[model samples]
Target chain A: MFRSRTRFRAYSLAASCLLLGVSSSALAGDAPSTIDPLNSPSWQYVQARYFDGQKLIFDDRIKVLAPTAAEDPLDVPIMVTSDGIADVEEVVVIADLNPIQKILAYQPKRASPDISFRFKVEQSTPVRAAMRTKDGVWHLGGTWLSAAGGGCTTPSGGSSGLWQGHLGEVNARIWPREDKNQRLRLRVIHPMDTGLAKGVPVFYIDQITLRDDSGAELATLQPFEPISENPVLSFDLKNVGPVHVEGHDIQGNTFTATIQP
Target chain B: MRNGVIGLATFVSVAAGAGDDYHLQPVPVGDSAQVFVGKTEGFARGNGGNIVNTGFIVGTDGVIVIDSGPSRAYGEQQRAAIEKQTALPIRQVFITHAHPDHFLGDQAYSGIAISALPKTIAAIRDHGEALSDNLYRLLGGWMLGTRLVPPDHAAQPGTVIVAGRKLRLIAAQGHTDADLMIFDEATRTLFAGDLVFFQRAPTTPNANIEQWLSTLDTIDQLDFQYLVPGHGPIVQDHAAIAQTRDYLRWLSTTLHNAATRGWDIQEVMQTPIPERFRSLSVLDQEFPRSVTHLYPDIELNVLPKQTAAKHE
Candidate 1:
């Protein structure tokens, strides 16, 4: 197989070289050369934000786990589990490279030891997983990447012009067998633009909140540059209740969905 | 030397932010071969042995250029250098692949026959503007120094351009679907782009390892004397191609096992690049991402929904 593949590729190379007879003069037109990054700004500070002079310490306890060291960095799998996370009431994932610093913020409703969800990393940077436990102690974990680059710069999603066409479609699927009530997964389709790119218009999601069918807020996530293009989130939901999530970006774009019980 | 962001800027940012021991050095190739901007030398050497250089082939009638530097502004700088070196006009720009750094400068060569693989042209048309837009938005004022140019002509198999010298666009898949290596029958020099990493782990996101490995075998059979990569200094030895082949062989095997074990993607992601591969450029960063890309290549039958979750 290897020998045949080699022979075939060689034949193709020779063929490609033969096709080099196009008019060289016809291919000489050059496009404009100046590029400006600030023409659009999607989010402010796009990556992580430091506050109150209390720098979030970097520890190895917090890490993002996912398949393929490289995926569309936007929706990379991330989980925050640590021995020190038991007392945490809220955690924020921030990406500092983007026009926006805050990616997603999770405010737990109950006392949970750890939190897991799938989030985006716009580029290869030090991702700060900052958690504030019930007692107000902030613990942070940091991980570095080299390849998941240009997250803020990579095109919005796999499909072109989908964000504009499906401006209001928010899809959520809870897995582990819907009745198993073991795991919950949710996805949102929004432009999630950082407003930094050129040509395309700017839009943002002002606010987004996930609630239970009984009108109780289960989780609230704020999207930012670190949140990837189309945001997919997953976590553990122990109780048997119809899950509902609502989100509204800075552009007044709103999305609401209910997971079948 | 106008506004230019070479590997140095990227390395400095990594060091100051992450506290890692990072170093970047510039390497010179040819007699006064430079990569535009302030990088007077021909190559920019990053930590872990990654190098990127820009060179032009001067023929009696015209010049055939390889990958342009980071941006259009930088490309203009490269053009200035080219003018200094050769009186012949740059009549053709042959892109070896579609990575932003490789093909973005097509705009600087006005009226030049820009050539690349068919997929490369499609990728540029598909994502070229978006890439420029993203750079502008993310880098802000810093992006002004860089420029991206979409290709004017697709270098499909059999598309030929006779400019004093015969230059062929070889169909070499693996580094990217748009991967192409420009072969000059005159010098027997192959501009392998990212397909042939000189001293680093060639990034394999859009890469087809199997096809890439096979391409290497084809390259070995070719009668080429010189080799240039998308992100490294020129290669005088054919063994560089073999080295890249060995690295991929290892990666293909290791990652295949991890995927089969149903290992957590992050666990596989966090697993450090073995000590052997660490010296390669972009290995630390590109390795994990390569894992995700490789999974799909090996587990061909598995559905995306079963193997992975949506990005959101």
Candidate 2:
């Protein structure tokens, strides 16, 4: 089993080299360059599948905050912030080696350039956040995080129906930022099981939609099982007046909440 | 020069917290033995779980250190502190268990013969990386350059002469599947390892309560003037063993009863702390974690019995 996995990884490496238009000899040379996300076949596939021919520029201005090693792989908190960039079109988060690599992509509507979210990390892998500017150039930033693995495969601690009573319970708080923007933080109770765990099957919240009091969709979120149990997300809200959140799980259970400021 | 600057910056970040600083001040136990009792603190980002107690016995020509602390820096400080009092070289380091706090520091004791049970060596080999990663997250920069060092010698259950002093290594299984208890024949001092935790609530994340209770009984039978536990203060009386035994019994009973009644884990966690255990260090923090670890097993055990009873 281990030998096959190693062989598969070697094949992927060779395939990645071929796809990135780089010779294998260049990869094995002295003074080898640092790992670039654009050179990764996974990132290339994400870009081709999501952005459709958009040019991505490596930018250090797009700051990302994540631990070099995660204590609990089930809930790895990450924050992505960009400065000196104008007219952001979308921000996409990719866990380069995850089974479902494209974790989240945010098309901000009247929101700030900063966002914080938590997701499950499968193993030691690179976590990338790419910001698409108004000119259609994708600026990418990422960091390598080391984990003990099995975050997605292991059974969640709440597997014994412990969360049944608290499912869909929502806690919403709004804090005013210094720049006159309000940060909307929402925590919903759900066990985002990844089905890889023994006997857990795939139970997770599949979608969440945020709307204003007038029923206008403010933003939509499509989350996967990799999101931590009792999912919490924070968004910088520009026009905040009695926001309502509606969500549905893979089991077809719908959850709704109202936040008044 | 740049590397030196980066190293200095890392050291400064790690040393910024006075509470997390690695300092071992040896206090005399019994007549000739000395012990360094670490603070009974919980695992945090700052402290890195440096809460286990370690001690040393000065023999005729050298010293035998019991249970290295939680990190490389801790073991280095411990070695320095031992050298401050005696000029004897550390001949052998005895690891009490496979827990990261007890064995991770083996990296600092370079060239010394580090010893542990065969199971402990296997555990260190299997789980050491995961444990190190966990410690890295907890200690951050404090765990700089710390790596897992496997034991060089197998500490079998027998007496071994170290520097003309007879040291008895006994295999005790309860607190962990394989625990080593060291006894100094010259001083009548027993290093009880994690088999005993005094004043502080004992952590049983990897314990078998019944086997641990039997091990406690075995420890009670040993002839010792002074007892050094894996955590908290030294023990002078046999009654101290009862504290850990009672807590284990209470925890097991609580978990079993809750499981039999089909109560939720949150409800079981809400089981009020006994008045006697309220003053134990880190009780509030560790009890819930212990419940989380042991309750699932209890539920599994009881669920099968319940089904059998219903069929009967």
Candidate 3:
């Protein structure tokens, strides 16, 4: 059993026959959401690399929701929400087995712990979200997203100077929903190229900062190359009116946009 | 004699999987255009990649084949089926685009002048082998001995006289980089290959959403009564054009908004498809595919940008 467990989790999902042209909706009905004990073989490396060989506890406080299979490996959207985890300092997402792991590291200062964004996957693997509480405990949660594999190794369709004319353009919308909840969503036009594709450089958005009109920080996200091109990030805010989206690409070109409610 | 004939026929059927037969039937459109309506499904072994609409126009002097079909076998069988309808010699073949479904069968029309838009011809020349190999994988034995054949003649936009019939070749783009729509003036029939899909969801593997939407409007303005689509049913009214436009517009708008709203691929896929388009054949398969092909770019365009902080 341990030997079988050592194989890549995505390879196991691939063997389960997800690619015989079965419509994704059909496989979606089955729920395999909960798996225990940090089951992935890459967990050791991830723990040593990101968690510093520290003991991490599996907790329900951190939740991850993603599609069972990635239709387009370059843009697999995922949501990571924390429940009953108070004083959370930061959340780090990792896709075990991806050549380039550490999808993104998020610090939710003024926005809700709930966040949704897109990422790239090179293959089927365990995607985990670990939230560190103020007490220094790392709470982990994740799911297995099955894919035909090669979300990274494959050349990105949007990487061919596709963003040349409109590079650095930003479109944002901040609206208030009922019950006083304000939603913040925006997209930045940049290739976020993984440099995995031939003749392509490793350029991507290094960081994003959301702030209120007064220049007070809302939330900051550090996205890696696995983030899809033109990274679209969404967050729910407890505050209201005039949110500013700010960030820059790897080339040191910076940009800023403000959405008024 | 009947027993001997039956025995020979049985022998032919026994060679099944050797790319022997397409068993095509021509459905008459208006006065002279005969369309071979294909299955409302993607390429599969059961359909032998016969999921494309190929037809011919029978004129006073000769016949003009609209498209070549999917494989050499389909093209040969299409020719046989056309022969059963008229004695006119096959005069000209016009390809709509370079998509494998539209022109892979050109191998069978070797002697005839197979024509297409200049860009269409170049696309086939560049990607023909890869596309044909994919069909062989999808259809297995049905693709037996099939090879890619690019159109030899460059057909410009405007009227072309073929076999005594005046055809208005309308050049457009969107569904693919180069889409050629043929209008049979004599019959008031428009052979809109892949440009218009009726009762089936349009495939957008090579689409530019904004351009496609604009082209749909242009097609709606054309003067034609009968329409032959690349993959679905033939229609007399403008329902096909409407359905095609409605679906594409919704897809493009929804994808853009989804990206702007930071919705992921799964979220976009899970969003309920409007009930109006639920009945379209292959929507289930085509919807996801279009999203895969189009969503990333749509997202890239509308997704906000963070640029160099402005001075001052």
Candidate 4:
């Protein structure tokens, strides 16, 4: 009886091995490692290398809201407000997975802790909103995104350099559908190539600076190679006046647009 | 030697002014064949010329093209440039792949024998019009838009066409579903389309990095002296092929490890291109994308199917 049991056990083990081999063979060519999305050193570097030892605090005082989807991921509308926390001092947003990580950082001069801005995302990734308090502690909140790929590598909109030729006609839109008194969103159509895209001899934004009717600085925006193709900046510019925004890229090309409030 | 130096000298100014952007230039690689390099538009993504070479086999009958330009505008320029070199009517056109830029110029060869991988021909026949229409909609506003032309003839693997000299088509599948590499045994030249990108970075969105590397291995073993890439300059040295092959191989191995760990695709997009593969030009611009596209394929552990499956 013992000998018979041993033989049966051995036979079943061999059968299971055979089945495993066949199943594995069937999936031989199909494997995740072949083309896994999140498995790049760059991806790891952004997470493991950049976010190390950094504190991303949670701030109930700040709230971020935007539409679920937009035509371009790079320039999505986002509104940041310090609804409860009067201690809020600054707001910074980082697209943890953008070719450029630091998306937008806003420093509020007035006590109005509320802010709005438009920023671009290359692909679907998580965006973190960190609010700094009077105590200098950073609070964090964000959303994960499945972004449109190929936009970063794909050609920009327009036929050649016509957009640059017409840079004077900068279009701007202010956001906050419900609470207009508190927040404002802005978007600019600049060919913010970030010096990485092809076709352009030099890659840089032609402009940056937002001012009031009297040419007073309301919010200042700077772009880096990490800024999405066309910058979609959302900021908290609120007042009863004419606002003019001017920007000059690294190449000394300048463009300005005025917003009537 | 002095003429070549003068030619190189003139090229530097143009290259410097163009900087990262490509300036259309002519590269004469063979006794009878010359390639017209295509520069991308100012806002477009590619920096290097989409190298489109129309070669003359110099046979008794007429001239045959290894591949045509990517668009109708490029096709006209290529044909005009060919006209300047030799007035031999373009008798046949061997398409390398079905990419809009690679075979969209078939309309230029109207009545010529438009040959490609059998599967590629079917793909072009099945989806060429829709793809062309989409491209026209997406990119047509520039440069008078693009024209669409379908293929006529289909060639399977191991197919040989012997006119004055023998030509063999090797169906290489790492770049696209059906990428054909034409071997000119007489000239020892390999007309490799997107399969090779020479100095420029290659697009690996639809590639199987492993298969691509193996195909390169197969190509290295073949006794070819010259390799004409789909994009970038002509590669006279056999070692140039290694540049592309090494990048793909290194990318596959490095990205695979990252995927095994739980890295986010978004995070990967923001990171810099791998330092190891920076030697290939366009790494900064192309690497993020290659990482994005290649990561998904590796994470999935299989190549994305050329055609999606139907489910009710």
The model with the greatest DockQ is: 3
Please tell me the TM-score of chain B in candidate 3 relative to the true structure's chain B. 0.91
lDDT of 4 by residue, B142-186 (tens): 223345677778766674654455777798888878889887777
Given candidate 4, what's the lDDT at residue B115? 84
lDDT of 4 by residue, A64-122 (tens): 55433333454454555566665665666666667667765555543255544445667
For model 1 the TM-score comes to: 0.57
Candidate 4 stretches with Cα past 4 Å from truth are A1-261, B1-26, B38-56, B126-145, B270-276, B300-312
Kindly give the stretch of ten consecutive residues in candidate 1 chain B with the minimal lDDT sum: B41-50
On a 0 to 100 scale, what is the lDDT of residue B72 in model 3? Answer: 78
Tens digits of lDDT, candidate 1, A39-116 = 212112221124342333444566544343425656565666665456566777754454455667777663233454
DockQ of 1: 0.07
Tens digits of per-residue lDDT for model 1, B169-213: 778787887577777776777767778876666677587888889
Predicted candidate 3, C-alpha RMSD: 9.2
lDDT at position A117, candidate 4? 48
On residues B202-234, what C-alpha lDDT tens digit does candidate 3 reach at each position? Answer: 999899978988998998899889989888899
Name the TM-score of chain A in model 4: 0.62
**CA lDDT scores, all candidates in order:** 0.57, 0.76, 0.80, 0.57
**Model 2 stretches astray by more than 4 angstroms:** A1-150, A153-261, B1-20, B45-48, B305-312
Per-residue lDDT of A234 in model 2 = 72
Give the better candidate number (1 or 2) by lDDT.
2
